[model samples]
Target: MARVQFENIYKRFGKVEVVHDVSFDIKDKEFMVLVGPSGCGKSTCLRMVAGLEEPSEGQIYIGDRMVNGVDPKDRDIAMVFQNYALYPHMTVFDNMAFGLKLRHFPKAQIQKRVEEAAATLGLENLLKRKPKELSGGQRQRVALGRAIVREAQVFLMDEPLSNLDAKLRVETRANIIKLHQSIQTTTIYVTHDQVEAMTMGDRIAVLNGGVIQQLGTPQELYDRPSNMFVAGFIGTPGMNFFPGAKVVAEGDTTKIVLDGMGQVEVPADYAKIARDAAGKELTFGIRPSHLEDAALVGEDSQRSSIDGTVDVVENLGNELQVYLTAGGKNIIATLDSRSRVVAGNKVKLYVENDRMHLFDTATGEAFF
Candidate 1:
């Protein structure tokens, strides 16, 4: 029953506005992530929710109560910060039990809660170890264990896995996911990493310049980005952009013409829109994965193809990352590793016509 809601929230410091008109609801037992670059107001929003900072305008609700002025201790929420924040001298059990002890809980009850959380996080064997004795991942688990023993209605995690190494990050990520499934607590996680957002969140809120660009499930943001920013920011290598392109009708076929490169026949489904935009400048976008070596495609395939000189080829065992210059612009393509394409070679790239994207050059809004 611990659903969190932000209604038209805004935050400002002096003359500078940070968070702008942000509104979203995190349902009970849902895992939500606030993702963006540094200074994007993601951490500020989380702080507002935690009662560490108050919004300049709008209401914040946790469950049935409006908690605008509530103290962090009274918010019925547990927060795990980027730093483990453990007492260095205390053993794992003591650190986990500290909060409960501060509130003067019965010794037996405190022991039971701490032991249960320890077991949940697989820290039973390390109960006697101090924070300095534990590894990065282990220390993170202790932080999580400390939060869990509270059995709070909501959990707020801010970049909890960023401190871990790459391999440990993956392992800790899985552990957090498993922990969420087991407890079913309403959780809001914040991170700058899209991979973490994609893998951990049930829904993601993408923010930039203190504004939320889009809020939806990860797949929705990926497959159907509402604007150029979300489209470019969500993917790994990101969607490629060809600026100042134009759409025009040549006979019955509508083609997107890129200066100095070539034209691509627009798919039938998008022909009308392309036709309507004829002679006007637009940005064409396509993912690297959608481009492939033309030689490998069947000769009779209807894929629109373009030619580019390969600048570099990165063989990644399973796939090849090829960087090429096309139409006076740099383009990246993820292709099959077995293909013989190499640096300094001129190669034809097949574009997945149906997967192409168009955006208004001025506003950076998607046309899909």
Candidate 2:
């Protein structure tokens, strides 16, 4: 029941800077996710918060107190790691109570806390079992249970589900979400997976090259990305980018000369913004799902449509990905998973104006 704050955090290892002026506020009980690619400094940022690595500059606050010089244990936060880090010789119960034992908590109090955490995590039956006898998911649960017994104000997790199998990862992900809802601890989960961030975070902070690209709700980031990098990174199949220029007219009409979809009228709300970039070189972005099959083009009269050859096909359960080349550019369309489309076939796809994103070709800044 505490808020975590990073104020202008900066981390550097010698001459190479890892995190650059990163700052964010995690409200009490908020499940904030830190996400990016492998070298994006997400883990370094998390480590700074956990007191494992001090920031080169800036202050970290836990609740109302500045904790920049505080030790990890005194910060009143519990951490779960990618590895279970369980003691092989100790039973699950002992493993969970180890922290309390080291802190000199009374035996009776430690037992009660351990039992409660194990029960909450469905680890009651595995209490007598050692880490070796437990499955990967079970071992992970023990690790989480160890943290839960401490009842810290904040929970810090670093890819806690990465070690599980695909099915188990999904299950564990759901479990973690449910656990957070029940306990309502302020959680800061760090991971390189955008899917996990989208599914788990109340708000996701997108990072790149040690800088935050965007910080907003999942829908906000997906619908209105601040820049080109975020627009291409958030979605499943991601947004398709192409070279184009805005088309403006005398009567407030706006459009783009897309090589594949042709010139389609921009949505009325977007006309003013779109008109600002007329005749200028820019990048056009559209989500794969934003494009629709020509035959089922709904009431979206502002959409641009064109015919193209499907270069490749990816059949997923609920959707099919059609790779197409248009206007000398390669683009992907994610249509109904049931759509019976294959590679090298001609098909019609449409991209509505409102769903389109425009970015300056030179600066990569969003034009609309």
User: TM-scores, in order shown?
Assistant: 0.96, 0.95
Question: Measured by TM-score, how close is model 1 to the native structure?
Answer: 0.96
lDDT of 1 at 51: 98
Using TM-score as the measure, which candidate wins?
1
What is the model-wide C-alpha lDDT for candidate 1? 0.91
In candidate 1, what are the lDDT values of residues 1-120, reduced to their tens digit?
399999999999988999999999999999999999989998899999999999999999999899999999999899999987899999999999999999899999999999999888
lDDT of 2 by residue, 1-368 (tens): 89999999999999889999999999999999999989999889888888999999999999999999899889999999998689999999999999999999999999999998988899989999989999988999999999999999999999999999999999999989988999999999999888999999999999999999999999999999989888888988888887765575756556676654566667788777777776578887888888877766665533477567789988877778788887767888888775666687777777766788888888788876
For candidate 1, list the clashing residue pairs, or say none: none
Candidate 2 TM-score to native: 0.95
| Clashes, model 1 | 0
Model 1: lowest-lDDT 10 consecutive positions = 298-307
